[model samples]
Every structure is written in C-alpha cells, then in structure tokens.
Target: MVERYAVPDHQWDMIADIVSPPQKMGRPRRDDRLMLNGIFWILCSGAQWRDLPERFGSWKTVYQRFRQWRDDGTFEQVLSRLHLRLRQDGLMDLDTWM
Candidate 1:
C-alpha cells in the first residue's frame, strides 16, 4: 500500500516546478519529492527532526530546506495553488475543512 502520508505523484507534479524550478544552477539539488515526504513524515509523526528516516537523507538538510521554504513563503504559494486546483476540480470544500 502507498504510505498514508506520502505525497502522491499527481500532487507532486503540481508543485514540483514551484518547489524546484528547472532554471536553478549549481550541483543538482537534492530530491525535492524526497525532501517533501520527509517534511510530511515529520509533521504527521510529530517527531523531532533528528528522528527523520535515513531514506530522507540528512535530517539537517531536510530541516534547513523546510526553514527556507517556510521563510520564503514557498509553502504559502504551494498551498494556494493546491487549494485553487482542488477548488476548481470540486474536490475541496473549504467550509468543511474549517
């Protein structure tokens, strides 16, 4: 079975560009989807960053990326885009989520 909290491919596709654009320079970035799943795993498990799984790579790296995304409002943009997409598809009803 798919991991309960893992981000699905479709959803990942939706935010992949925003999270890591193709024009980025330097050595290739760490796997964004893996980092994202690491973040989600921590959030869902309510665990400390140090407790992150080895499959997700270094906990420090994931934590740093999380901080960068948060401080840069990247999370906000991702959520906004997801909300819009779900709303347009009649999949999300904000009233119920409240």
Candidate 2:
C-alpha cells in the first residue's frame, strides 16, 4: 500500500541525486527519502509543525533541512533537472497548444 506523503520509488529515483545529496561528514545522514516524505507531508497537508507524525523522523530535523534547501536554491535546481529529464524522456510535450 502507498503510504501517505511517501515519494514513489520510480519518481524518487529520478530526482534523488538533486534533492538528497550525500552528506560528507561526521556520520551517515538519516534517510533523505524519509525526510523528503516528511517535508512533502507538511507542505501538502498544511499541518502545524508540532503536529507532524513521528514515523518520518523528528519534525524539527525535517523543518530545518527544508529551510536550508529553500535558502540554498536547491529546490530551483531540482525543478530544472527534473524538467530536463522529462524532456529527454519525451514525457513533456512542447506542442503549441500546451
């Protein structure tokens, strides 16, 4: 069954590199995939920060990471990369009507 707010494996694989970079320090990072799910959940649900469900990890960590990415332009970078990927795959039609 599909979990709410979870990223699909296929879709995640396409943009994982852009959104979830390998952190090169102290210890291995928490699962970026799960953190992303938590991020999407908050944004999509419009839930208050304290209300975040625990399965996705500490809401505090997720929120902090979200802010970091937003400030760093990673979101824009990911969108551009995904758009390019879609174009390459012919999934995006650039027809005049579109």
Candidate 3:
C-alpha cells in the first residue's frame, strides 16, 4: 500500500466545509479540494502557483484544479457564501461605509 502523506484533517475539513465537493467524474485518485486549497494558499501568499511546495502535491494539479473551479463558478460560490455568512454574523457590515 502506498503511504499517503496525511494532510491536516482540520484544515481539510474547514476547506471542505466552505466548498462543495467536486463531482467525481475523472481520475478517482485526484483530490480537487486539496488542489484548490494549494492554489488558494499560493494566491494568498502572493506567490506563483508554480512555486507551490511539494507538500501540497503537484503544482500542475493545483493549477489545473484552480482553472477548473474558476470556469465552473465554484470559487465564486464559495466566496459568496463566506461573504454572506460574514455579513450575517455582523463581522462585515456594508452599511458602515454609508
């Protein structure tokens, strides 16, 4: 059995909580959320996705997943949900600017 490097469960769970699971249609071994998180981490760190560390898996995989999510509106849905949740919690008040 190939030893899989265990990604932090909590972090993975949080990411999963924020985003809907990708439909399993292609390769069964591919992890769409992990790949997308790696791409997001790169963006948040202001680094190129190509510079992503090996611990996050292949950079190409992450990049491809990011592109797929972008095209499918997955990223937008996640962001919108987060924004709405924040607004509902009063953590982000648009009316403060008015």
Candidate 4:
C-alpha cells in the first residue's frame, strides 16, 4: 500500500519543478514525487532496499536515481534555488538554519 512517506502535494510543490528530471529523447521521467518519496521512505524507514514498497517501483531504480542526483549536483541546485527563494522572501536565515 502507498504510505505517508509519499510526498504530499504541498511539500512536492516546493521542489517539484526543480527536481524533475531533464527531458530528453529518452524514456519519459517517472513521477518525481514518487521517486522522492521512495528515497524518503528508505531514509525514514531505515529498511533494506528489498523492503521498499512496490508502489515506489523497484528499489534499484530509486537507488540509482538517488545516486545519479547526488553525483550530478541536482541536490545542490535544489538547495541553492530554495535558499535564493527563501532569502528573497525573508524566510530563511542561514544563522538559524546553519
């Protein structure tokens, strides 16, 4: 069954566009939220990959994508963008966050 770790709309809305895979002449990207949720589930549940809920697709796929994002700096880009937005809105203080 689908679980709570599946990213809800509001949380996904914040990072959705940025986290989406870049479109190319290849397989259409899987839902970014699903993948993110899969990652979250693993981190939050602290389970073996084989234990990943099937609703999240194969754990290997999620693992590969997570590794890809980490290696390619996608996480940094997302953080940078979020920081910029928060700074513009006076919502994020590095002093407090750091």
lDDT of 2: 0.84
Candidate 3 per-residue C-alpha lDDT over 1-98 given as tens digits, one digit per residue, 9 for 90 to 100: 22243336654564575454655686564665567558767877788877888877988887877788788887787777667767888898877733
By lDDT, the best candidate is 1
lDDT of 4 by residue, 64-88 (tens): 8899889998889888888988998
Clashes of each: 0, 0, 0, 0
**What is the alpha-carbon lDDT for the whole of candidate 1?**
0.90
Evaluation by lDDT, superior candidate among 2 and 3: 2
**TM-score winner:** 1
TM-score of 3: 0.67
lDDT of 3 at 31: 66
The regions of model 2 sitting more than 4 angstroms off are 93-98
Which runs of model 3 end up more than 4 angstroms from their true locations?
Answer: 1-24, 96-98
Per-residue accuracy of model 1 over 1-98 as CA lDDT, tens digit each: 55767888877889988987785578887888889899999999999999999989999999999999999999999999989998999999989966
Ranking by lDDT: 1, 2, 4, 3
Model 2 residue 1 distance off true place after TM-score fit, in angstroms: 3.0
What is the number of residue pairs that collide in model 2? 0
Per-residue lDDT over 1-98 for candidate 2, one digit per residue giving the tens place of the 0 to 100 score? 66987889888987898788878788787788888888999999999877889988888998887898889998889888877888899888767324
TM-score of each: 0.87, 0.83, 0.67, 0.79
